[model samples]
Target: MNLGLTPSVACVKPKPEDSFAISFAPLSVEDVYAKADDPANGAVVVMSGMVRNQTEGKPVVALEYQAYEPMAMQVFYQIAAEIRQKWSIVTRVVIYHRIGRLQVGEISVLVAVGCPHRSEAFEACRYAIDTLKHNAPIWKKEHWADGSSSWVSIGACETQGC
Candidate 1:
């Protein structure tokens, strides 16, 4: 049976071992890792995206995140499906993203992949985050120390070295 939020994609049922969510509360690495943990897997690789203190040499105080929730959740399911297609040994996939203002050092996103081998786990986890960054309908505003703020596009990672 599928769990977590329902996928907006038609005819696509998310696996019971796979989970996705967009939350306003602070994300926890331990909780995300546990969600991806499985006895059938030897490795669970997790990638935690945190709000950092600086960006492009500018001091940052906090970040505000927003998402088109339905679409973002659909993209999360697509990412997990792609991972499973690429790594058949993958046992679980868990993705969580935070929305609202987040202070520096706070977790913003977490992507975890469980696989029987470390290599596949790492590769799948990397793929999940990269895909999410590029495809998810999520946006973030950087709150600068200078009392300024600006919305950053998803492609900002490519041009701004994020």
Candidate 2:
């Protein structure tokens, strides 16, 4: 069987044991980099997403995350396979996403990819996030200080402000 990444990317919510460290609170770039380190890993690229206070000019109080665990896992595995097959330089990659209660200024997700060179690492890491956003089942619920909240769906406009 070929252990190669597919042309299309998939996203998953990795198990804690399979991940460097998985938590609902926040993610750390340093932690991801530390786990991604290896003798064979010459280059490491890291991406961190922070919870912004505003979306479309509105203030966000807090956020809740939910996911479809089984599908999420499947997507993640496919992503790993695809990356391995497409990129010769990339050796390993780690993607950590938080699903649960999260506050502002907290890390929502982290992606780290290691390769033989910086370019490959960067490409793989970037691809991971973009694909995850497109394919993952993770959803966000934004709470407002005015005693109101709304479930923010993926692909929705939450960039303005919460």
lDDT (Cα, tens digit) per residue for candidate 2, span 1-162: 987834233454443322433366567788888776667877988889878898888898788888765656565666666677778667667878888888898888888887888888888888878877766666889988787899866621232131
In terms of lDDT, the poorest run of 10 residues in model 2 is 153-162
Q: In terms of TM-score, how similar is model 1 to the real structure?
A: 0.88
lDDT to native, each model? 0.88, 0.71
Cα lDDT of candidate 2 equals 0.71
Candidate 1 lDDT, tens digit per residue, 1-162? 766754334435689879899999878889999999999989999999999999999999999998888777877888899899999999999999999999999999999999999999999999999988887778899999999999986622433343
TM-scores across all candidates? 0.88, 0.79
**Candidate achieving the largest TM-score:** 1
